[model samples]
Target: MSNVQDAIVNAKDKLPNVTPTPPGFHPEASVHELKSRLLWGEPGLSIIDVRDHDAYNQCRIRGAMNMPMDRLPGGAEFSLQKDRDIYVYGANSGDTSQAVQMLREAGFRRVAELKGGLEAWREIDGPLEGVDSMDDPGPDAYNVFARLQAFNEEKAKEKRMK
Candidate 1:
């Protein structure tokens, strides 16, 4: 093989596994898996919290949209395409499983239960909303524009360093 071809092969081999993992349904997924997927920034996926309103308002996986169990089916049908990759959770594992089942039965094929829900996510230091009660706020914690700008700058710096 030419030098360029060999280098391309080597680089592809070293690429992060998560980047090559196509979005799809799994019966369950750990917080770390979901975190990697989010950091990889593939679009076409969503995190859903099926917990009640108050609980969802208190804490949840950042970027999660709430659709309490009672309203889940209708809500999902209204907003989501059947093939979109969806990660769902509730108050606990059991609830999470139930929510996943509900979504699957509703004709949504790519639905995975988020294992361990919010607590597991917290254990992994995953980004969260409604975390004001738990820790001191960072300067751009709730500032979307500021956070986006900082993220963009950091990514640019990393690219330059690379």
Candidate 2:
């Protein structure tokens, strides 16, 4: 029994239970607070929506820019100055965190994630434009919508040919 206990202690020591930082950007404020900050806070903060283009166009924070995660690293076309605060958010938690990390790696210093993503924004009654608030679709839904739209256009062309 002592030998087994010794082995267990050794194994435990070898396996350091390091808690990873909670995934996603940690917002300094709730959605309402964010809204107020954006609208009333000091100048220089930029809101960045890290979802796809369609999602961004469908409905997003009024002035937020669409900076998709997959296209990051080499695809970013903006000049984000090091001194400005950058707020990032997506449809959900995990993706937003991943986006924040990518931005940090790409050299963004002042970065934060909207707590709970857009869903939380809706919860806080944050205003949005374009699509309805009820139409908060996930990433996969956006992909499906894009494919369907393409297929519909192709079918229209075929009909015109006949």
Candidate 3:
């Protein structure tokens, strides 16, 4: 083999084998996995919400930074380390994967799509902010909505006691 060919082979070997994905991790990380990591106090990672500004501002996972999908490259480049662990989610898995693909193409080495997006996070009772308290009852109160309703009920009970 030519010297250049040998060098190329060496470089390829150094790159991670992304096809099979690393053991104990997936290209799309589950909400449970992320929750465990947060509980374990894992460091060297960042979560990105790729939804639009309005949605992100209205409600988002606590500690997640906004980096809208359309603005990913520019939004992330200045603030985020290319090699650090990045867990990203958008409106759904497809949007999340698209963002992840873009980040990888832009030379980010450790971007992972967050599976099930914000809904799953909320299901797991993950921390969140920017959501307004619901004033009226709505259909299908469960998970996050259930928690909010519970809070409101507790507050009402307290007021009655007072």
Candidate 4:
């Protein structure tokens, strides 16, 4: 058999369960967990910001949609599916929890409160978009390897500090 075929066979034997497993969907998720999902290019989940219009326009998790608290349930009902995995946040933990409760009451089964909101995401340097996040994406924006390396460094720094 070819060397490539042999390598594949060996690899399969060594790691029989190897597969793409995105971060777990839970009632609450950490910023790192969400970041890991984005880095792996998983798009099965949604991030919703429950903050008001101005707050959302200022900054938010890159792909997050703004669904302000007052109208959040109605907006989400109109736009999102009941079983969709959703990571929600707001101006604070209280708001985040409240949004999660609202979505659950609205019959959405898979909803999670993203603990620490935008501040936690920014602490780990997650990609963001909005007028307040207008700074250049830097020279390495498209360099996946460099971004991964930076992520690793941040993780290690976090570990060392703790």
Best by lDDT: 4
lDDT of 3 by residue, 7-108 (tens): 764564345544211123346677765655554445778999999989998888878999998797888888998887889999888889899999989888
For model 2, state the Cα shift of residue 143 in Å.
41
Clashing pairs in 3: none
Local accuracy of candidate 2 as per-residue lDDT tens digits, 15-70: 53252111112333346435544433236677888889999988887668788887
- Angstrom error of the Cα, residue 161, model 1: value is 30
What TM-score, over all chains together, does every model reach? 0.69, 0.59, 0.65, 0.76
Q: Worst lDDT window (10 residues) for model 3?
A: 17-26
Candidate 4 shows a clash count of: 0
Compared with the true structure, the alpha-carbon lDDT of candidate 3 equals 0.70
Worst 10 residues of 1 by lDDT: 17-26
**Model 4's lDDT to the true fold?**
0.80
- By summed lDDT, which 10 consecutive residues of candidate 2 come out lowest? 19-28
Off by over 4 Å in 4: 1-20, 138-162
- The top-ranked prediction according to TM-score is 4
Q: List model 1 lDDT by residue over 96-158, tens digit each.
A: 888889898999977888878888888867788874536544776567566455444433443
Per-residue error for 55 in candidate 1, Å, reads 0.8
Predictions in order: lDDT: 0.74, 0.61, 0.70, 0.80
lDDT of 4 by residue, 1-162 (tens): 346755764564345223433345557778876786676567788999999999999999999999999997999999999988899999999999999999999999878899788999999788889999964678986797876765555444534544
Worst 10 residues of 4 by lDDT: 13-22
Of 3 and 4, which scores higher on lDDT? 4
